[model samples]
Target: MEYPTIEQLHTKLINKEITVADLVAEYVDRAKASDLNAFREIFADTDIAAQVAVAEAMFQQGTATVLTGMPIALKDNILFGGHVVSGSSKMLEHYTASYDATVVAKMKEAGAVIIGRTNMDEFAMGSSTENSAYGPTKNPHDTSKVPGGSSGGSAAAVAAGLCVAAFGSDTGGSIRQPAAFTGIVGLLPTYGSVSRHGLMAMGSSLDVIGPMTHTVGDAKIFYDAFKGKDSYDGTSQEQSIAVSLKKKLAMPKFDKGGIDPEVLSNFEMIVEGLKKEGFTIDEIELPHFADALAVYYILMPAEVSSNLARLDGIRYGDRAESVSINDVYGDTRGALFGPETRRRILVGTYVLSHGYYDAYYNKAVALRATIRKELEQALETYDAILTPTTPTPAFGIGEKVNDPVSMYLSDLFTVPANIAHHPALSVPSGKSAAGLPVGVQFIGARFGEETLFALGKIVEDIR
Candidate 1:
């Protein structure tokens, strides 16, 4: 049987149909039995029981928060105080967090039972979870295929019924692609809407933490709990901007060879379904949308190169012993970081270098602004912009891992929202003939998540 969503679980707790302890225990066992290897660590049985007891008391006192007694699995990149918070990288393999990330603190305050830490690509760097230092996470639906990453494990955990809902970080398509691959809902909130205080930095400007869940409502529950201003993160803002759904949305003016045939077919079905439900479907032109993937690659890697400089042997991560201090730096990084990470760092450094800065990094930034404006203009006329969450369903593990260009192409459809700093939600559209899941995205204007949720519910019913 499938696990109930947060809303259903809440009702069950109130009616004494299931105890909080029972629910947590059930999920913990479910995780252990899975062959997908979705978790890096499942909290100790004793530790989980103690949390369960606290939630049980919340039920008894009638003081339960929306997520009280509910089990949640966090992407490995999110910090949990006193736990090993590796970003699935050997560099930080033994490093432990001393404080909770803003999101982690909020989850605890709301009485969420954090069951474990899920795996991810090393330093949140790849389209597929294959970059994980430990091992690649397999898709829950088909073990031969990959679960999209760097949030693949969180996506798989939720898909396999191991958790009611889970948290995943989105830097490019990490969360949404995996969610699509696994047949769940993945939401990427507008930049600065959620705190970034304790998250292990990737592309600091592009990275965001959001929910992976079974339904639009379930994702909304978690999104509401975490968003707002945080004293610890200057980028976070308490957004009070209000948006109303227009019952209208826009789609890109397709370029030849833009998307996979299967995905295009499912998207057409989604458009027709929405039109039948009284939605105004328009093909709005965002001319700069064509350049988003390139823009993201330039900007994201530039940020990644800058942010990752801190992982030197001195401050944190595993250190290498060397005669010269400078050699220690080279030795530690050379031995610990993965190939994909090393590739991005090199690209980032090249673009940010003195001679190339104006030619590359500056241009990406200028174009990013233009792209954001294009999305802004579209939103004035439509509730959201729609696209396939990924070009194709999850590919077989090792299929694209050896080809970097092909791997990057997996993120083509999902990079625009990150580049534009807009919010996007991925909901399962339908499945392929081979039974693989496919997802469609709804991109909203800045701080316009509610509009996406409203339309997302309609998409869910149609699917």
Candidate 2:
């Protein structure tokens, strides 16, 4: 009854030790037990049964891929044609995607099975999953604590062993922060490395899709399956440069070892373990990192305001039945949006207003350029930058929910990578004194996924 990873499950299928139907049934049961409020919707048994049938046929024909019949959870924002794509908001609760996202399409081509949609922050705006319309997803480590967000459900599902792996979007650390809280590996690819075609826009330039799994190797496998150029996404670049750069970069040295007392000790232990394995550890500082959260809030909300402008109820979402068009637009948005969404929308509007555009929005854009330049310079000397994924582990479910600023600060460490357009990964380093998981982040230059995978492997091995 043990849950196997994607790789292990593939081997089991090949050896006939477990059938696809049996594997699917095991996950279904685990999901049912933990429930965890992780899934907003679990796929119907009939749908899973049909997928297992195809997997069984593929196995018999010796055509199964590594992901054949593998169950994967999805953050609700990513479209999966015919499935609801609510982005964890009440605004589009009944809306279904007419087509699959580029990442989803690739997952299907690799023969992965979509188990269900997981919960998240409304429109991917908050750091805690509490902003979800359904409810916050609880941390598997401690049910009273949050799992992190807006990709909290994806991380929680993986940590709770509900699925082999899950797909999560990262814009200001949605995926990495949650993975840290839940004791798993979360990968955020270099911006534009993965196609953003069907993902609901939060901050368009900052969002990137990545994988969350229990191990680094699984992260690599999933990233390989979906990364590369996609015609539908003009931003996706060819993988040739990324592949070549990965081969050239040296693995990072785990120096500058101090972290929080508990996190510091664990990080030191991991470094020593890696040193014995012959990997060099180096200490480097990224000064602009301190200003990342401020920069992120200013830039992300400005973009959110613009991207969400299309949702005025006149476009694709639910419309208010009102006598006037103005009332229809105003009432629908006011009714559907959560506090965080409204806050960002207001901030966005303020920054973009005629009198303030040059002072606020323009200033933030200039700071973004500086941050990006600083990160690029740092990567020239260090293969990757290392840090704690979060300032602390998962807190109480509603602990910081009402305090928007405090919630935004939770993403402080992870947001710098997004602002810099660099790839980052969060791997479980150890546990906090409270027994909650502690994660360490590895950030690399553009197209630096290979470095992340290499460093991630080294860290995970030591941990």
Candidate 3:
């Protein structure tokens, strides 16, 4: 990696070779100069200086945590108290958070500077940041293409050197896909391993807040800081495990029908590299893989419909006046939400409706459980499972806006991990013929992030 790792920067801070104020100033300058549209705000006033001074004092007192003085970006969906958190939607565009999310509190307690919130798909419903109400975040490597949504802005921010690292919530493949598109490291930690207290809900069962950074080592530094239980979130857990790495990994038997040709070739290259490193590579059957995407679309929008209900124009966003309460609700939501958000809400409500409930929603839930069981059974025999993070590299902006089914196909490989409730990471493997980045993903058992990180370093070292 051209950029220094988090540990190296920490060493410099501890040795008095650099100061927090200086680091923040330089990063702030870089962020301002960026053309990627990565940030929603940059604390252009003295707020950044104020936060840096506190971190500077921690360094002076020799009481700094691993993240002390580090400048990091948070996805717009994450709530940082007293700041506007719109989730890139007009419904909450003018709303301000009342309190910080648990993860934000943890980062602040550790002395990390919260630079600003980055852009995302409105309500995190789209696969590309082009759906953002503000504007699409351009890929740093190639502006004509997307940086992947809904965490596109955060990934772009890190890749463009605007921040040392950034946090993005992955509902399906939001974080991992964007990281892959931008050629950075992205980790979707085990479900329940990190608190979702402050992250805006997309799919309650699927959302995860994770790191985007230049290298896997930097990702570890960020992950270790906030992966734990929080009373505010019912699903959060204090998952404890001893770190271990086996010299073997596994991949599913390929069903070449849906995968992009370049992605398959990249997967082959990764397999060859792992074999050269003396790690055994085996192909196992995951028959359920074929049905994963269909399963995800059903469950995700159902959750999306349920979670977004609280944002009534009366309580949360721009209001509409009418004598009838129904019109107030309809007009407000209809006008404020984007087309994709409305579509999902309608689909979600339809599936959860009376006659269709058992046919669609219930069946999907049952299949989801079976998928999780099959994955757990597979993990017993393999250290980790590998696949391409995204089926193709970043598509051009507006290319799939009118084609929702094709857009959803982008998450073909990633949705399975979220459905199975396992942890996964996207490591930049190689470049596509178009010179865009290609990502290979590793899915491990719950709380198996350590093994993924270890292998991710090997892949990073491949270059």
Candidate 4:
């Protein structure tokens, strides 16, 4: 039950070999029957029928695009008008969207069939989907293991063939890490390249919407459709940058002590394969690279604390009944927010508190700029930066849940790109000895997604 790529489905739809309704129905049935819990809700039949009708008309009218008739899944945090977008939390469990997220609106205009919203970490916190209020999403390759967090459900849905492709927001490796765990392709577009008008903000500066799919080609098609500036989003940029493949990649020096032996071995094989393809690999020095995780932890939570303040019962989400205003705020948050979400909020609040702001938050902000400069300088010499997407393959579901520090370390390799506001692509490199998949990541310069696509395609062919 391998799901076809967007282009493959487009060919079928154009030739009339398969109607959009039939294609969407097949995926809807799979989503309904799957035990992975990848989706929070499979849209009602009437809702899907309406989308199918629009897709059919696009084909009949000869205005169909590459994504027309493709069944796509959205992360639960993304708003879709008239549908419940819970952000995988009880707070917004019954909150229906009043309008579409910019990305959703763009997809609708492209004639992509919206299957349903997939599960995620509560308010996009935690490194495992275990934080999801609805329970965890299992890895398709091994049910005992996790699919990786934040975007775990989106990754699992694609890997399990429940949808043609799915969209996930990458805030500190959410999309790429999950794609690695689930054996799929995930792209973290350059910040500001894709509009974030309606996306639920986790770390506003670090978040970027990207495509998770079986191939880099499919990701490109999906990205091209939804990327552009929007008046609704001031961060959205209109950068006119050139894309060129220098055939040169940068590898930073780092300790492999904590990384899995098999992951390291697989990454070496990928490097060797690329060398044979005439690509040059250079081991370079990035002095501030080691501090990326620390800086990300400080900056991200500060933003999370500020952004989530709106979720206090009154403005949005479910309210807790209490007499005093303070009681209502405290009780509602304490009762509805997951442990991981609450932990971040507390940490964020402490860092931003008056006495500690300069010591923790401000210092982190300065270090973040230093780290970004190091990456940018490195990119100027090399076309892209390379690393294993995650230090280890997918761990057991409850393996790191209780150990917060260990869980945060899972994002070590993938967080640098987000911290630097750069685009990154995670491609399946090979499988580990235990038969779990591992991915190799490519971090390109801002607006250099073309460079990533070019290199990713080569990796696909050689690997």
Best candidate (score: TM-score): 4
C-alpha displacement of 79 in model 1, angstroms? 0.8
Alpha carbon deviation, residue 439, candidate 1 (Å) = 0.7
TM-scores for all candidates?
Answer: 0.98, 0.94, 0.98, 0.99
Best by lDDT: 4
Q: Give the residue spans of candidate 2 off by over 4 A.
A: 1-3, 240-260, 275-282
How would you encode candidate 1's per-residue C-alpha lDDT over 154-245 as one tens digit per residue? 99999999999999999898989999999999999999999999999999889899999999999999999999999998989877457576
Show pairs that collide, candidate 4.
none
Q: Candidate 4 overall Cα lDDT vs. reference?
A: 0.92
The 0-to-1 C-alpha lDDT of every candidate, in the order given, reads: 0.90, 0.84, 0.89, 0.92
Query: How well is each residue in 28-67 modelled by candidate 2, as lDDT tens digits?
Result: 7888777589998898888778777877787888878898
Model 1 CA RMSD to the hidden true structure, in angstroms: 1.1
Q: Give a tens-digit lDDT track for model 3, residues 275-337.
A: 899889888888887577888999999999999998777777577776688898888889889
Of the two candidates 2 and 3, the one with more favorable lDDT, higher being better, is 3
Which regions of candidate 1 fall more than 4 Å away from where they truly are? 240-243, 256-258
TM-score of 1: 0.98
Residue 176, candidate 2: how far off, in angstroms? 0.5
Let me know the TM-score candidate 4 reaches against the reference structure: 0.99
lDDT of 4 at 11: 88
